[model samples]
Target: MTAPTPAAGAPDRAAPPGRPDGTERARGIRGVQPVAPLLGVLALGVCLVTSLDVVTAAVALGIEVALLPLLRIPPRTLLLRTSPVLVAVPLTAISIALYGRPSGRHWFDLGPAHVTDGSLTLALATALRVLAVGLPAVVLFIRVDPTDLADGLAQLLRLPARFVLGALAAVRMMTLLGEDWRQLGMARRARGVADTGRLRRGATMAFALLVLALRRATTLAVAMESRGFGAPGRRTWARTARFAGPEWAMVGVLVGIGVVSISVAVCAGTWRA
Candidate 1:
């Protein structure tokens, strides 16, 4: 008996060979249109809390945490993605406490590096504010596909088509560089290269990767130019990027969070700046 083939233009029954399906990619707020405005809001929030306002930072962080469920980002995935920032926050706080400008009552004196009440407060505020700002940005950007970001930049922001497409291409290549580096290491191992002399081997591998990257970049530039990327004619987008009510609403929600946080801090007399 002959099996039936998929009809022309019909959706495939199976997922692509190695790529995740749309469901996996669509977990969070999965578009760049909303992210653009959300980013602006976060930037403004960063500025508002830059004066070491601990109460404001805490409130903003609480609000951001409350909104996390709406983004549909898995807690484990989010932690893994933002682990660097999470680790750095404490280290930064410690540095600020140890070496920051001295003010208020002295807490500890270690020669030139002194810890004061003001320095400690500033350190806590700095760490919390970084979390408040960085967490949301990380979560939002994870859901944004490079193609969607390119579309949003070109369509919504009116950026030059060539620049946006070039950025997209570069971002796509970076994701593969890790695998390429791993393969290069494996090749060296198979060739019986001794792992002694770390500096020499690292320099050689880096030079090889640089040469490969330059060649790939040259090829990409040629291909893009051949397709009339930098031409003077009016260009059209393959996908529509909308900045509509939903995008505006997301920005408004973020703005409200910032305002409420500041107001609470001010009323409670914790807003030092």
Candidate 2:
């Protein structure tokens, strides 16, 4: 047989030296099943919620911060996504410090509100706990695609397909809410109703948005039902959601962090329940 000649413009499939191939590159945490991170977050939250100790929350928060580099999130994006938590933590701490159960020496006092040593400590713990739990969740979810999550829930977790798909649709629709609100505002301005009282304009816009959302939901339900999504038969998934070694390892790491945090708090005698 004659040897075949190379075709013109054929691309090479081989990876360059010291560089990862497509499959190797896809092996990062981003490629793991979505359920793994979801369960991991839940486990971490459960572990932290069991105690109201500064030690546990602080330890967990420290570990989470250390792992931030591995998540490969840009600093600006991380800050923006986690801004809500950052703002909320201070508010939560302030509220708790002022109104929390008082014990030990009092630092400040007002009508039905006191900032004591114990209350301050409790407030700090609560704030840290919220940060520890919320930070990782926001970061992890930033990488999770809604479709992938729905697939994982339906296939790997054995959840009802209808529920998973419905939730996924709802998530997808949430992104449109900003655009919808903008359009509603423009319409109101065109109709000369938006230049009035700010509160009244906001109230009217909110009601309109609510009505639009309900209408969208009804239309979507009808469309989905028409497409046989509401059928009670076995459904085949387009992608297989695998819960293999990597997913297990991710879950294990989160669980280990939780256990160590709890253990440290217990040993330090700071654990409260």
Candidate 3:
């Protein structure tokens, strides 16, 4: 009996030729990814444990930021300078204060609610924990080129290609959103229906952007169907994705963070007891 031939069109399994990051900025970004796996790991841990022992997570973040040069991601594009994360930081804090744990001593009772020192402490811990976890994911992913990340995730974690491939395609098309936005703005101005007041203008701009996005999305769907992107066949990778030194280093960093953070929490508990 003849062995069944491997399915046609599977992506190549061999590691591809490597390229070096020559830009100082890219170097810094690349450096961060090694630590990013760690930061992201610790952040996930803190979220699960919800404890104040975030020294490990903080340390992981610090290392990742310091090594940011190695990730080869641009600071501006990588969410290093994004406003959303900054906004999230404070919002996390507020959430803790409003809905955090109830405490032993009630400072005040506002009918069905009591505010206490314990709740305050819990809120603080919760806020810190959230930021510690979320920041790294955002940082790592923002700077990460979608294609590279999809490649890494697929090869290292063995994720199904369909989803990752779809995400990659989506990201590749995101660039067009900006151009569409510009055109939509021009069109709105031409129609004389655009808002002039600051409050209305901002809202109008958001609505306009959303409409432009929806239209592009429709166009993209039609384009994909026409191009046979969804056809069943072996796909080829233009760039080789490998989980070598960088990936291992990242995992090691994460494990190290888990050890350190949990250890500190244990020590602190013992001290209190």
Candidate 2 segments whose C-alpha is farther than 4 A from its true place: 1-28, 184-208
Candidate 2, run of 10 with poorest lDDT: 17-26
Compute each candidate's TM-score over C-alphas.
0.83, 0.82, 0.66
lDDT of the structure predicted as candidate 3: 0.60
For model 2, what is the alpha-carbon lDDT of residue 119?
A: 94
* Candidate-wise lDDT, in order: 0.79, 0.89, 0.60
- Candidate 1 per-residue lDDT over residues 123-222, each given as its tens digit: 9998998888887777777776777777777888788898989999999899878887888899998888837778888888889888889999999899
Candidate 2 lDDT over residue span 61-159, tens digit each: 999999889988899999999999999999999999999989999987898899899999999999999999999789888877787788888998899
**Each prediction's number of clashing residue pairs:** 0, 0, 25
The lDDT-based order of candidates, best leading, equals 2, 1, 3
Q: After superposing candidate 1, which stretches have Cα over 4 Å from the reference?
A: 1-34, 44-47, 194-199
Candidate 3's TM-score:
0.66
> Which one wins on TM-score?
1
